[model samples]
Target: MELSSFLLAVIEDLGADLDPPTRYTRYVNALVAALPGNACALLKMEGKALKPLAVHGLTPDSLGRRFELSEHPRLNAIVTYRGVTHFPNKSTLPDPYDGLLEGVHAGDLNVHDCMGCALHVNGKLWGAITLDSLRAGVFDARVERAMAMFARLGEAVVNVAGLSESAAAWRPDTLNVKDLGMLEAVQLARHDMIGDSDAMHTLKREIQTVSRSQLAVLVHGETGVGKELVAQALHAMSDRANLPLVVINCAALPDQLIESELFGHVKGAFSGADNNRQGKFEMANGGTLFLDEVGELSASAQAKLLRVLQSGQVQRVGSDREHQVDVRIVAASNRDLAAEVKAGRFRADLYHRLCVYPLHIPPLRERGDDVVLLAGYFLEQNRSRLGLRNLRLGRGCEAALKHYSWPGNVRELEHTLGRAALKARRDGLGAMVTVELEHLDLLSELPTQACAVINSVNNAARMSMPMGEVSYREAIDGFSKNLIQRVLVETQGNRAAAARQLGLDSGNFHRMLKRLELL
Candidate 1:
């Protein structure tokens, strides 16, 4: 067949009516089959594996498992060296896929000759197309010429078809855009929280399911995972968005003042109560009140707070009158409320109440490839923020963020990218805005912030935990305790404000703080 005819056929096949998502795969299969042979294959690269995108005349299950490029010396050789290698007889070359080759031979297709070409897009290796025939030595000079033309045409079609990124790691059918940029992903706000890995998807689904309710939610996760964002999302998407989203930091305030801050105090209620002040509850009336580091609330405070949640009423200090407040409570704490309850540090009833709905946000390290999406978002956001339009992450920055365990979660990433963009913009003197990963070096600084936090004793001591391999559940509890203690200090024991800042439910935050014995 003439090269032009083959090109036209392939082009037309791609443009034909098919499922919008799978059209490219269909085109690749059709192009590979047009060769004058019974066995033809088209493969696209995704991560470490070169996936068989389209196949025909080979066997029934030709596209089952992906062909690892590292295992296929011939294919790998072609892909690695950027050249197409052909041999008329199988015996002439070292066969990399020994078992696969034998299976093909058993199928009664004696490869007298074969021709294959590397598919290139953006001048880089994208994948390969191979045609096998039963006629020995049939792939003559003419066949090679035809294969070359097919490869060239295939390159254009592949590029235009938008399959240049390869089909394995980047299956658009599987890649929902919403999941990609989900920094604080949960099903309620957006759905595309993409990670096939068990841990990630589990967290994503849990967040989605838990997001539907107004019940006080307790989010337990590591420091960097976006807990507060989850709380904000809950409030923003819930029936309470139109009202105030009030935040308080239990750890940020003095222990004695917590009750007054949450329930509000009338003038002359206590020392320095010179004027009447509406507390967070009053401020957040008919809205969502987020109590972050909630475990830091004192026992007396917890009892009073529980009554308010249970009764939907609050009595101001120095006032006998109780006011009705319609507020949805969301609480977050980086502490183990159960442990606090056992230790007599937290109220069990409050813990149960706050845990009516729970959301756990995963850290950046567990988001898999979502790191790249978030990095891009941060990079762009920072670029605009710093007034540096050309600033972008270099290859190293991109790869570093992907591999780096973001201990601080989304906030850390945003800060790092913003700082890096600024540094890059300044260093380049406007010559280069593409930032290298010097900022990622900040990853090592995560532990420095994790020193001995004030425990329930309000005394500094390294937190004690069971030593040895632990489960995700255990890790979450420990991290929560550590984070609650730390955020309380950072936010100065103000639960409501801290909850807002950390994107967590204030009530749940209080529960965890209580459980962790912070109260």
Candidate 2:
């Protein structure tokens, strides 16, 4: 094929955002007029080294095929001069490009015959492209010109990427969320919450780091120890606070409508997309997009999301024209992404990028001083919130609060405090509010356990043996043991609290603990 057509094809490929693996060989073949005797290569600047970008002529057995940029004068000169550098005589060349190369020769590849061009775009050195031949004089004027042109094409492609970013900066989202990592307490704290525990301090610091960068952040925690609260704090402190902080519950959204909700659709895109619609990206254009329970996203949805994040562009469900968007993503999940990745249920790359800075909210039971501090803050807030006159936790109640293993984390605490406060505010009955949570009931969790027990009973009843006579007590005990073990893990080995939560007195709890061999 003619060298011009080859170079043109190379330009087209680069325009397609060519992947790294084959980009070098394709460019080398297109630029070198006559094929080099064996293998040829293109090396580019990376950190402190000029690593091989593409290798073609390396022996099926040649060692040290990769050459270092700093160690090699040829590649270094390419980075330094920001122009084409050729062999010994440049005075005989057609004309001066950057006039970069005067008397340079590539000695590191140690190949006797080769030329290289430095890739620069908007005055910055991006990389270099080299066209080498085993035979001397193989790269003629036509070949040299094509190499230079295609190098410019590579630069042009990078320039286009730069343009996309610049355009994103001017768009509503990028400009608004100037600092997506900030964790300012003023914007987030509804009441004065004073907690100097290590957990709280670490959380605050993470909030600050996430506030400064526009990257995906993953917030992980058990069922509500303030995971969503942390996400809200992120949004409130970020530059996008003024814009919509759109929150989507991936767990709640149905699979069928999730795509339409997230990416929007044209009129008639689906059965119910009657009118043209804008998706979450468009809605969250000028702000932070918070996705709760993101781990619940379907596999297909994860791929589409991965594409949007990778490209910074989104196409509506039905439409073909992809809208360029600038959206900062902050996702929260209760599941372990590492496990998900291992299970092949989640993309590894997406997991790393999303967890660029992971902030794991400590459960209430594990927050050290934050537990008391946050509980007090919630108490007062609930007081005003529910119009309670005067209610307080009794000495025993305070001890119970501190002693019980809060399995549901902050959500459980919130529910407990809110209900306790409401009960203490009895007016018509004229009942004096006592601090003793004797009425706290601590027994609401039984309905769930009872439901499980009922199911077990029904399954056992199918055996045709007299119901309740054949003691499946062992099975029930095993189930309880498993539940206890899981709760112990969640509570980090607070045995007393775990026993109290199981509704056992200290003596009975000890016996059960001994039976379970869980001293």
Candidate 3:
């Protein structure tokens, strides 16, 4: 394909209505066809990282990975350079996608030729279009010039695709950057909705719609499904975004202290009170107050909470004066509050108040290949933390991850990768670590028929147990040893993480490991 024809095609497609991913992908595909490269990617700059928006000739998991400039020298150079930058065949800088090229084996992971040009949309640095070739000297001077022209078309693609609206929305003066810069703030807001699943798309749209109002929002999701993150997203996109978003876990406090925490108490009102403290409501005045585990509130606590919601006023503990507060409420729960209300455990009125606008987060098992994308995100994070040159999933690992029913959801996926990375490193794989299926340690959740088959086998094995031969103490000791050993392996030999999972004290766990001679 000639560069002129490719540019003309992109210009012609400018008026077509297409999704951002589809549009970005068209640009990447066209660029790869026109240029001399084995792999090409269209990345978007977000905060300090570069996220691949579209890819051709790269692994699917590559879409999930975020390349932080500080960690990826090649990407940093590409984005920092004024125009098209080409790396020599033997450049010392590491390739960010060393082993990510599609159809490439592990033995031939090195990218010999590379060139990229940073993209600018409306005079601001948007991202870059990177191309990599396996054969050396493929990206010569002429190819570099073509890349520069393609970058111009890439910028136009972003503009015509209507993504420039959101990209331009985050003005420096409007955002309150306490510790984050303009780029970081915009990036954080944009990347908050990470997945491309239909359920996730619906949830994102609901969040955007509900954020404009002051109605209380109830976030519903299973444990480890990131209900708190949903609350954060709601507050971040709300009208009161600039104001504080104070969070309080209702289940973390005792029944007696719930009121004191929700409504401020005067000094000496409580036994442990050393000074007059403003409660969560007062602290979040004109902002948002996120109540986590809201269904755990006691009956009396529920009444007090209902009163505040009804009156838009709070009376502190041991005080007669009532103070008015302009605060938006966002509550989250793992349990079904409506079920609790039906059972006469939760107040129906309080439930109604909080459920004015409800948002349900889809579980990991239902989000399809989003599991792999999320894994990619975690892999990059682990790579930086573990000080590795590169970290990626091994062959067939993506399929295994997608098929496993993640009962513990996103948190479990994160810990699983963290442990896998540790295991791969401990095995002396060095800087370039690959997490294989075995490293995942996923026990498939069996179907009913499969369980029946296992049950028959278990019965046969039990018949041969010789139950009286082993003493009760011996049986218990064996069980304990097996459990500890399994946990150690699952945690990748991290004794601290293992102890936490088992709900044991660190000191006690260490002593037990010593007693079992497994340390």
Candidate 4:
């Protein structure tokens, strides 16, 4: 591929009206055509980390991994140097993409050629573009000059893409030391929400739009779908970012103590009220109060919360004096509050108040390749924790991860990768540990014995029903009850193990048991 051809291709792409992600992807593709390497990546610097925005000839999971300057010396060198820095074949610095290149093993990268240049737009340091080849002496003087020219084109591409609303909304700024740690924490919270799928892109746009408004947001998602992370991002991107973010887990509090917990209690107010205390509302006076599992609030608790939200005031349990506090509300729930309202389990008024701006997070199964990307993120954490030089998915593992239905969503994927990494480490795959498919504990696909039990129970449930016709809902409930009981009996009443075997969250399974009157 020639430089002239690359320029012509970029111009053609720019002339077409495309989304920011698609535009950036086309730009990387063009860069790969003009560069002299098997792999090319366009990374954007965020605080002290470099995030891959687009890549060519690299594994899909590479987009999920963040390269920190303190961890990857080669990237640090590329970002700090002005000119194109080409590393010798014997350079001591380790490659961040070890075991990450498509169809290339970590062992094959011992003496590969690498070169990169820091990109700039409007005279400010934007990010970096890197190119790598598995063979030595691939990045010669001519290729170096070509990289420099392509780097300039990369800047122009970013400049054109930055005009879009989505790209302009999330442009990262260079931060100092004081803000870096805070930014890192915020980034970690944003990590789980990473994906280029249409569902994710819509959620992100909705977040950006609602974060600036003061209306209450109700985040709805399945268990392990990261509702809390969505709340964190909402608060962080809101006007109240610098203020405190108070979190209250509604399900964790007892029915008898929920009022005192939210409204605070005076001395001798109740059995354990020995000292003056401040409740969650007062503590979050000028900030955001995150109510996790808002559907679990008791009837009495719901009335008190509604009063406070209506009046912007809270009255202590033992005192009549009401204190005024301005607090923003961001509530999250795994259960369908609308369904709960219809069933009379949750208050309809309170539901309406909390759901002013409803934000729904897509389940993991709906996000196609995001599973692999998130797997890479967790694998990186495990690699650092287990003291392995590199951790990556082996042959067919990516397919296994992407094809299976993630019932528990991101949380289950995190746990699955952690366990797989440990198992692979125990197998002594040396410094470059490759997690194979067998190491994954994917419970969505049950064993033959378990399947047989489920089948038998389902048939028995149907046959035992009365002769009269029944609704589909009733039939499903009967089968579900029998299946839960069978699993419980098989596990010897270990609810956690039973839930695992049935591919359900423990809390969800417990709720099912209660609903079916099997508790």
Best by TM-score: 3
Q: Between 2 and 4, whose TM-score is larger?
A: 4
Among all windows of ten consecutive residues in candidate 4, which has the lowest summed lDDT?
A: 173-182
Residue 191 shift from truth in candidate 1, angstroms: 15
Clashing pairs in 3: none
- How do the residues 22-117 of candidate 1 rate in per-residue lDDT, one tens digit apiece? 554555555555556646767776555565555554321234334446545566766665455676676554332221221222223334566578
RMSD of 1: 20.2
Where does candidate 4 clash, by residue pair?
none
In candidate 4, residue 14 scores what lDDT?
Answer: 66
The Cα RMSD in angstroms, rounded to one decimal, for candidate 3 relative to the true structure is: 14.8
Tens digits of per-residue lDDT, candidate 2, 414-468, equal 7777777776665213322333345555534344654454445434433423343
Q: What is the C-alpha lDDT of each candidate?
A: 0.61, 0.60, 0.78, 0.80
Instruction: Tell me the tens digit of each residue's lDDT in model 4 across 1-519.
Output: 568888788878766778666788888888887776888899988777888889888887989988778888899999998899999789988788888887565567777889999998899888999999888998899889878888887888887776563444454432222233333466664567766565676777677778769999999999999888888878887789989899999999998888788989899988878999999999998999999999988898898899898899998889989999989999999999999999999989999999999999999877756787898888878887887778888755664675567789999999889999999998855568889767885524755554454445445435544443653235546767877787889999999898767655455567668868998
Q: Candidate 3: misplaced stretches above 4 Å?
A: 1-3, 163-192, 428-430, 443-519
* Alpha carbon lDDT at 315, candidate 1: 84
Each model's TM-score? Answer: 0.50, 0.49, 0.81, 0.79
| Candidate with best lDDT | 4
Give the residue spans of candidate 4 off by over 4 A.
11-18, 165-185, 443-519
Model with the higher TM-score, candidate 1 or 4: 4
lDDT per residue as tens, model 3, 1-519: 568898888877777777576788888888898888888999988878898989988877788888989998889998998699899888988888887775454556664898899998788899999999988988888898889888888889988765534543365322222212322344354333466665665676677667669999999999998887778777777778899999999999798888889998988887988788889999999999999999999999999999999999998887889999999999999999999999999999999999999999988776655777788888888889988887887654664675567789888888899999888777645446778656877535634433333344334334434453543223434555777798889999999898766544455567668868886
Off by over 4 Å in 1: 1-208, 442-519
